[model samples]
Target: MIWDNNFAVSIFPILLQGLWVTVQITLLGTLLAAVLGLVFAVLRRLAIPVLSQVVSFLVVFVRGTPLLVQAYVAFFVLPAYGVSFNALTTGIVVIGVNYSAYMAEVYRSGIQGVPKGQWEAATALSLPGVRTWGRIILPQAIRTVVPMLGNYLIQMFKDSAVLSAITVVELMATAQAIGSSSFRYIEPLTLAALLFLAVSYPASRLVNRLERRYAPQH
Candidate 1:
């Protein structure tokens, strides 16, 4: 038969195993991106003459480069300098750092969205710099940031497929391996695409809901 039901059924479990790895990469990468992005945003927001300029340039550089090249450097070149990690670890870190540049911009916008009155209030009360940001600025800023972060999470989930090139054995990689070994492409590839849609579609909807919920009132 052109499309073998039994073969597809047999490989479903294996594909799921790969899907789990993809999920792991997505979750860990998004977490890393969110934290690192905040750091980048804050550094820039501080507007320290040297530090802010350096951070801004680095963010721009990362945003300008292609993710595949970044992955290649991390997986292939870093080892010569003794900065090697396992394939999955390298993939997660590369993906996280790559997305961090974009997330930094998102965070900056959210931070800028905060009302000037809040800053004045903190200054008037003699709140420490750390406390002003930690208690007042970040909480209000993060409410706006949450929905954008969720959207990035979904994007990263889909982008995890690119890491398959580094031998991460994520869902796309698993499907490709199955196709190569069995010389059958349609079933596994189609199923993999379906699995991606299954997760991303719902996540997108949730992000929309969050955006509406957190949207600033006019």
Candidate 2:
């Protein structure tokens, strides 16, 4: 049934709309994740008395939980407490927050990966903390982690399909809707997989290049 040309034509445009939504969520969610993850890394690195402890606990909690459970709670549970976000906003926030824990670890690895001598030299020069981090540390740290962060962004893009569970009309959700109505899951589902593969395969290649390019030259 799916091999029918007209059905393919009708489905392509619809899938494109779903793809756009997926892209939007991935972009915004990645932005939030990058910023929040960096903040978490800093807080934990700083090790301030209470704040650091709190951040540590949060990172563990978020990482330990399932993303789907997190999403369901954000969408379904919060509204009962008079807290509510629309499905798009809810999906974006949950994805961002969920990924933040993992990114924070990536950032921490990057920060720790920096040569200790660089930190010691900055301190010997009497550089303020902000100046040391901004002018020296973050520049090197971010570069070291760029490939890793890029990989995570690709991962997040694929994971955005999970948001469809909450009524976000992303790629998988669109496919599900089409399948439900037409009682034909094959074409729509295959189209979604191909769309994901189209984006992710090239991205995987790019990440591989970045990893090689950034690999420490012994």
Candidate 3:
């Protein structure tokens, strides 16, 4: 056997503790991403002169950059300006912003998918702008994109491992620490992969089910 029984038992609890940190960050990060992504989508849709252009530039820049670099800047660089965030807070914010860029695309597609006739009718009725979105546009758009947003949430959960670079001690960090110190790479790493697969596979299946449920069929 590549890993013996006693070693597996010893490491499981430690990994679980780290996994809890991962779960907390993933939940917070996904929430932040969902809200910020929709904000970006809405701002671009408004086409509000210079503001829209700036939002567009920000979205493009975030989507173009590497997330790990963003994490570094959030963790290491921000402190130089006296804008310090602890490792956990930094990880959550960085991951949230990184995923928000992709989520913005999903939100844009969903908003665009709404029937043009719906938009026209809202305008024709002289509906207040915020009321139009709140009553008509966002409801339909958000429903259409729920499954896609869930997929990003799953991706963000996996990506949370990257936070270990900033020393957040998530699941991957726990595995690496154990492996390096004990010289048993296989068990801790294997355990971490199993934990991820166990959660992500079921979540993916749930997304598929949501797509099937929500997809508009002729």
lDDT tens string, model 1, 1-218? 78889988999999999999999999999999999999999999999999999999999999999888899999999999999889999999999999999999999998899999999999999999999999999998888888899999999999999999989999999999999999999999988999999999999999999999988652
Q: Give RMSD (Å) of candidate 3 vs. truth.
A: 1.3
Evaluated at residue 172, the lDDT of candidate 1 is 99
lDDT string, candidate 3, 126-204, tens digits = 9999999999989888887888887987899899998899999999999999999999999999999999998899999
Q: Candidate 2 lDDT, tens digit per residue, 42-156?
A: 9999999999999999999999998999999999999999999899999999999999999999899888988898899999999999999999888888887888888988999
Query: Could you tell me every candidate's TM-score relative to the true structure?
Result: 0.97, 0.95, 0.96
Q: Which model, 2 or 3, shows the larger lDDT?
A: 2
Give the whole-model CA lDDT for all candidates, comma-separated.
0.94, 0.92, 0.91
Please give the range of 10 consecutive residues that has the lowest summed lDDT in model 1. Answer: 209-218
Better of 1 and 2 by lDDT: 1
- Top-down lDDT ranking: 1, 2, 3
Off by over 4 Å in 1: none
